[model samples]
Target: MGNFVRIPAGPDQSFDAWIEEPPADRFPGPRPALVVLPEIYNVNEWARGVARRYADAGFVALVPDLFWRLEPGQYLPYTPEAQQKGRDLYARLDVAASTRDIGSALAWLRARADSNGKVGVVGFCLGGQLAFLSGVDATPDAVVSYYGTDLHKFLDRVPQLRAPALLHFGETDTRVPASIAGEIERHKLPEQDLVTVVHPAAPHGFSRTGYEPFHAEADARAFEQTLSLFARTL
Candidate 1:
């Protein structure tokens, strides 16, 4: 349902993005685009499936290779060894440069002939953090972050966000406790009106299907909210 395409990132640099487009017969006119940021595992099957899901919902979806600089095309499973490897790569990630890459992806999506020029971003795990940063730096039409770790560190940038944003967290996620959500709510800059949802009993990666920590009810609820946001803003 999706295929990889190269998009220019920086000067003389490019990265692969898994792009999925809606059927033209069903979605006749230009359609809104979505950037599906991946977890630390990179553009794996699950991430590609997410792009396909958005495409099925009448939106053009693209999942960029956020870890290209560290290990191009790296895809890992949910095993403990893979988790450690992902953590190692994440620790060495150049967040500023990666945010620039996200900007490039948004530009590419908007430039597409089938695009309506309104782009939104959705991400998970490490990508979730990037999604929040995209709201502040890339300036997409909408942003959704699911259990984004270390989001408390970026509370100061909340005032700089121009796009409508949604954030989700798991009550049982030690990496992002309820206190973090409370802090985020307290720091909400005026007019931003960003939403933060903490699902009861949901652990980290609650939205990730086929994983041990997946919470189906929470995933469905969050996805519905995300679709609603895109409908209203994008």
Candidate 2:
């Protein structure tokens, strides 16, 4: 259902992205495209699964390796040691450059013959934060962030968002608590009404299926809302 493709990031730099396309017989024409941002663990199996899910839903999904600059093809597991390694790599990530890479991905998708010229972005964990940044800096048609850590730091940029945005947070998430989520909701600028959902008792990484701290109910609800958002906006 998917394969790796190279995308030009900047001059003399390129990165691999896992691309999945919906069945042509079922989708039957140019379809909306999606840029699926992976967590700090990079384009691991779970992240690729996300692209597959979006493809099955009739969208062309592409998952870029956000950590390519630091480690070209690193795919860490969900173990404690791997978690620490992911965090370390995440700390060294340059947000501005990664946002540029996302823009390149969007451009690639839009240039594709199968695209309908509509593109959206959905991200998890660290990717979630990048999604929010993309809303502020890039031109994705829509944005969705799941439990994005340090979102409060960028609350000031909410007013600059040109695309409709949906953010999901876990009520009990230590990285992004309910108070922070409330702050984001309250910081709306004029018509920039961002939809935020805080799942009750859900912990960080709630939407990550087959992983610890995954809340099935929250995952289902957030995914439904995400699909609805893309349907209406993209």
Candidate 3:
């Protein structure tokens, strides 16, 4: 249902992105779009798989290879040795550069036939933080964040997205400590609209199957609620 391709992000720089379209027989006309953001691994098989799932659900899904600026088509491992490399690469990333690349994808979607010009942002881990930030630059239809990494650190940077927002988190996620998540829950807004769901037994990456160590049975419930949020808002 999809494949990877390279596209220009800025002058003399190209990035890889997984573009997923629903089967031709299933998708007949223009549809909404979803920008699928990845975890620390950038655009890995799992991330692409998620894009396909979104496409199956009637969205044009795009997963960009954020690490491409440094190395094209790179996928780091979760091992201790590779973890250091991933951290180094993560540290080198310029937030403005990433938002620029993401904006390019959004522009492509809005102009394409499969998009109704309605866009939503969804991501896990590092990508989740970006999802929140993306809201500041543009008005998306909605934003969904899952156990967002470093979002608490940039809470001040959190965009007052006029669009509705739904956040999912794990109560036990040390990466996004419960304390900070609580603070996020306590904030007031002009819209006074935000949904924050905490999966009691899960931790960071709880929505992912392979993160079974931290996964919870309740994550399924959270997912259903997330879909409902999209339906109501997007």
The candidate that achieves the highest lDDT relative to the unseen native structure: 2
| Candidate 3: tens digits of C-alpha lDDT, residues 92-198 | 88877787777888877888866778878888888887887777666677888887777766666544655678778888887787566667766636464677777
lDDT winner between 1 and 3, please give it. Answer: 1
Taking the tens digit of each residue's C-alpha lDDT, what string does model 1 give over 1-234?
Answer: 678899997779999999999988899768999999988888888888888888999999999988898899888887789889889999999999888899999999999887789999999989999999998888699999988878888988877877899999988898777677788878887688598898888888898887777899988888999999999998
Q: lDDT at 170 for candidate 1?
A: 89
Taking all chains together, each candidate's TM-score versus the true structure is 0.97, 0.97, 0.90
Give residue 91's lDDT in candidate 3 (0 to 100): 88
Q: Which regions of candidate 2 deviate over 4 angstroms?
A: none
Superposed Cα deviation of residue 16, candidate 2 (Å): 0.5
Compared with the true structure, the alpha-carbon lDDT of candidate 2 equals 0.90
Off by over 4 Å in 3: 214-216
Report model 1's TM-score to 2 decimal places: 0.97
Please report, as a residue range, the 10-residue window in candidate 3 with the lowest summed lDDT: 209-218
Alpha-carbon shift of residue 153 in model 2 (angstroms)? 1.2
Model 1 weakest lDDT span, ten residues long:
184-193
Tens-digit per-residue lDDT, 1-234, candidate 2? 699999987789889999999988899768999999988898998999999899999999999998889988988888889889899999999999999999999999999998899999999999999999999899999999998878888988877877899999988899878687788877887688488888888889998888787899889989999999999988
RMSD of each: 1.1, 1.0, 2.0
* Model 2 weakest 10-residue run by lDDT: 185-194
Task: Report RMSD for candidate 3.
Answer: 2.0
Query: By the TM-score metric, which is better: model 2 or model 3?
Result: 2
